[model samples]
Target: MSAESDYVTLISSDGYSFVVQRSSACISAAIRRMLDPSLGFAESKTNTCRFENINGLVLEKVCEYFYYNEKHKNSKDVPDMDVPAELCLELLMAADYLNV
Candidate 1:
């Protein structure tokens, strides 16, 4: 692995993994702290976080929202981002886990 720590692998309970840019993933304060080098936490060293309680499907949507938020971070009139009705509860739970 490179020493740059430019990306992070988010591992879901079912072993699904999503690799995303560190910058974009840092949109969540919880994730930001996990990746913060100064914190010297295990996650910061490995650039990965495992959510044994989260399933892949919900995690996927949360990761999408992270990128969406990043793209609209500075926009004044950002368009509404939609989530599937069936995923509302799981999405909310995942958001809480990610502090999104």
Candidate 2:
């Protein structure tokens, strides 16, 4: 794949955009499907995904979790990710929707 295609852009509901490594983002099954080239989805063609129900703040944390998951995939002992209390519910809902 070309260097540009190695990354994907995730856009939040409120118009925020986050560019992350494709491999890291693919840790989420939903994302993996959305970006699959053979699927011929619009997201696959543009390498961009937009979450309608996920706001920018929540999506940012989701992206962080993606990287964290990728980094600790093979390790037994991993540090806990810091999550703000107020966002717990929203994050949980997003995680469920994303199937992360």
Clashing pairs in 1: none
Deviation (Å) of 71 in candidate 1: 1.0
Clashes of each: 0, 0
> Pick by lDDT: which candidate is best?
2
Q: Write the per-residue lDDT of candidate 2 for residues 1-100, one digit (tens) a residue.
A: 3323988999999999999999999988999999998887889988999999999999999989988888899999999999999999999999999998
* Candidate 1 overall lDDT versus native: 0.87
lDDT accuracy of residue 7 in candidate 2: 88
Please report, as a residue range, the 10-residue window in candidate 1 with the lowest summed lDDT.
1-10
RMSD of 2: 2.0
- Judging by TM-score against the true structure, name the best candidate: 2
Error of 2 at 65 (Å): 0.7
